[model samples]
Target: MLVDSHCHLDHLDLSDYQNSLDRLLDTARQRGVTQFLSVGVDLPSSSRLVELAQTRDDMLVSVGVHPLQRESPPLPEVTELLSLGSQPGVVAIGETGLDNYYDKDNAEWQEQSFISHLQAGAQLRKPVIVHTREARAQTMAILRDYASTSSGGVIHCFTENWDMAKAAMDLNFMISFSGIITFRNASALREVVKKVPLENMLVETDAPWLAPVPYRGKQNEPKYVVEVAKAVAEIKGVGWQQVAEVTTANFQRLFLP
Candidate 1:
């Protein structure tokens, strides 16, 4: 079975599913998507995600603020994040890291928030779900400083070059590709996928966004993660079964205790 290693279930546009999250998830299960990590973008969203996970056996959660919340309040203290992350069904810390691509003006605040999240993951002994955009170097540096095998994580929705992928792998972090890699212009990212070992790679939909080809320009769901996995297998010159089996295992290894 395949796991959607990262997604925002709380944020998905469920109008098409009769406004039913269960109907949406059931559709994904029919497509072989067995588990989901419904990511949180802030303290309030984290609380809501934890509640959502508790209602479904197949769902888990990650707590922490996203890097591009410029209009949002400053991140809570590390203690507060730890308190939230340690809650039941909360398996990871973050959808957090530096995103210079859009929020460059608040880079310092983002870095501070990222460090606190890294520390929280270490303290909780849970993996993190990082989101790095145009700030790869700084992101990696902070990760190297705070994260280790015991508190390792995955770089979700990875769109960087092989050098960055290699660097993140060296730090015991897995590289996860979203539906973006299925785009026609993502040949460079596909090349990165070829160079990275399948054992250290994962797949996500980043849903309600970045839907894979054939489904691009539409609302994404966990079922679409299969498309991302198919793309990865194609890039790595392997079968879809191998991508499904390995990436599912990779998700379990990182977020399942």
Candidate 2:
């Protein structure tokens, strides 16, 4: 089985599936993507995901305010995060971290929110689901300071260098590769994939976005995670089933424990 470790099910264009989440998930299951982590970008979305996961044994959820959510006033406080994060079926603390690529102006706010999520994760003993971009150095520093090694986490949709990957892994975090790795211009990212050990790796589609090649430009879905896994297998010089087995094992170890 394969797991799409990061996806926005609520944001998906489910029209093709008759606007049904169940139909969408059935398609993914048919493609061997049997598990999903529907990440949240804000409080309302987190609440929705929690509700969605409650009845689905194949689904898990993460609660947090994404760093780019400038509209979320007053930043995210540890108390607020703890309250939502403590819910059952909520296996992780964030789709949180710094993202300077899109909005460098909100760096301070992002850092504060990131720290709060890390604090909540540390307190709750749940792993974090980090979404970092152009702010690698700061992201690493904040994680090193606020994140607990025992709680751990995964650097979702990783597109950084080996140094950052090594640093995150050293902190007991897994590095997840998204469908971006399958793009023709992502040769550099594929190189990074080659160096990352399968034991510390995970695969995701980040669906409703970043659909893998052959499905690029189309609305992404959890079903496309198989393509991401196939890409990883090619980059790692391993069989596709082996990549699926290892990544599924890694996901269970980090999120299902």
**Cα lDDT tens digits for candidate 1, 81-118:** 99999899999999899988887888888989998998
Candidate 1 lDDT for residue 150: 72
lDDT for predicted candidate 1 compared with the true structure: 0.90
lDDT (CA) for every model shown? 0.90, 0.92
Write one digit per residue (lDDT tens) for candidate 2, span 66-165: 9889887688889988999999899999989999899999988999999999999999999999999999999999999999999899999999999999
Clash count for each candidate, listed in order shown: 0, 0
| lDDT for residue 107 in candidate 2, whole number 0-100 | 89
| TM-scores, all models, native as reference | 0.98, 0.98
Cα lDDT for residue 192, model 2? 95
